[model samples]
Target: MSLAPRTCPPVYTGSHLDTVPQGGKYDGALGITVPLAIANYWHQLGYRPVRPLCIIAFAEEEGTRFGKVCFGSQALTGKLKGLDPTALMTREGQNLPELLQASGLTGNPFTPHFPPGKCFLELHIEQGNALETAGFPLGIVSAIVGIRHFTLTFTGKANHAGTTSMDLRHDALAAASSFITHVYNSALASQRQYVATVGHIKVEPDANNVVPGKAEISLEIRSETDTLMDSVLAGFQEFLDHTAQKYGVAYEIAKLDQIPPLPMDASLKDLIAEEAQAQNIPYQVQPSWAGHDAMILGHELPTAMFFVPSKGGISHSPEEFTPSHDIGQAAQVLEKVLRRVSAE
Candidate 1:
């Protein structure tokens, strides 16, 4: 549907529609479904808010298809005004520019625009068992965690695996392995509740008879505080220095991205909390471990998130599940929040 105003809407309820490969049913879709349900409820009741209510089903949030997280939100925000669609391709080898052209977006450019004035609220699965484990149906998101990404590369001399002596030969993959171990242990010891992952890795000449000459791993760290993420990053750098020396290898660190933690609007968060209590739904205020479109839009609007418990702290997989009751409860809080914000 076309926007009624060129300017920002006073109220917005949206979530992404895309999912990762083999992704669960609830991850991005639940957020959109809940808001749409609320809009439909208001329509059935012939009720109207003080201002316009916009329901947006944003696309490509997972970025799994093209490796661009928050694609839809970024475009709506005008961040993609000059994006070169031809430079990106889907996993299935589909050309982005061609796809857009086919969808009738050839000459026209995309402008950033999910513009919200008074508030934006997103309801999503907790993606963790926090609420479920705590016996609460819903959660009030106080903040979204900050994220830092880096690429760590290790370089060493290639040698025949059979001819290389254990102490004399330098192995890039070995050094990479040590760094990964260090990351895991350090995260476990974090007092700031940090999570560090070396999820992607590759080694050159991946042969059983050849020593790896180079290894690269993608490193990501997340926490509620930027300072904490920095602290960990610094420590990792130091450890890498020692690792390079110890393994007789050289290392390089290339920084990729950093997303600062975003605190939800105080009043919006409080409103959700208050409404939860009023509705007799138990709630916990917590920080989101995973990223969300809410975090991106939070920078543009007074935003907040409501989370329903995932059955087993699972998400982004077919196993992800949230009870129907939990979803209904979270939706109720979002509806109440919208009503309160609209009146203000």
Candidate 2:
């Protein structure tokens, strides 16, 4: 049978775990090693792909050093602009641009992105319990949740905690606490697959004697549906307004980042399902709560991700693990999908 060969160059065939200091071994390594295993199997069987496959190992996906996640992918796609290299200083007090120039790269690092034709697949350990709880060995990702992050500040008049009467105090910390409660309640009440969290909070004048006059919190909202996320944000804004008025505090919010939800390629997902069935591997289709480089590149190219079950659905920890059988099943399915794509 004549096959249409894929022509994409520099396929990202690498482990993508640069962030999450002391991350699980399989989080990034499996995605890299599985493809190599498949290639070795094909070679042993005297099978050759119609298209050239190149494996690349990238070390900068975590963006811990530059404060930019998916640094390599984003840079190559020209998604990063107006970057002041001199302003970006490392923890060692070194300018990032100067470091790049010293390394023999002296131009605008951002380049125009070209759609590298189809055939992008990422195999990862499911960071959630969906697969394991459902007793599925493998899973095809349906979509990646959209993410919105914000920094909120609540400001009020600081005063002596012991002298301030309960009714007379314009407590920013109290208002912030109410907001945090609302966030939890709303998330629980949301009918859709939505989650809102106030993970970080700081109280100003954090002293036993001083009433907090300023509070800052880090808020993050995630949902598979953009419309749902927008609705949640609207409701949250209203709550924030009400809280500020209740405690006589002034509130401000600064948006940090917003990434839209991404749906997987329908045809590719179907192919993955077929391959799983053909291999007698139990699989499911699920939404990914966490972000990945696959989703970043998936927006521009036809990309697919297969997941192996994580023990107790835990990931990004030193104890994170996936059983060998689950890994094998996922790898086999990925191998089949790659072969089929190559033959198409």
- Candidate with the greatest TM-score versus the true structure: 1
- Clashes per candidate, residues 3 or more apart or on different chains: 5, 0
In angstroms, the error of model 1 at 308 is 0.4
Tens-place lDDT digits, model 1, residues 1-344: 12234353578887989888899999878888887888888878777776677777888898887898988888787778887767788877887778887798765345655554767888888888778878888788889999989998899988999888999889999999999999999999885488899999999988889999999999999998888887888898899999999999999999999889999999888888899999899888889999988987898888988788898898888898888877887888888887767654
- Regions more than 4 Å wrong, model 1: 1-9, 92-94, 104-109
- TM-score of predicted structure 2: 0.89
The local lDDT score (0 to 100) that residue 179 gets in candidate 2 is 93
| Global fold similarity of model 1 (TM-score) | 0.90
lDDT of 1 at 291: 90
- Local distance difference test values of all predictions, in order: 0.84, 0.80
lDDT (10s digit) by residue, model 2, range 1-344: 11234443433344474646777888867888888888888888888766555443444677778777777677666676667657767788888778888898777766544447545778888888888888888889999889999999999989998988999999999999999999999898875479888989999998878989999999999999899988888998999899889999999999999999998888889999999998788788888888887777786777778788999988878999999988877887888887877654
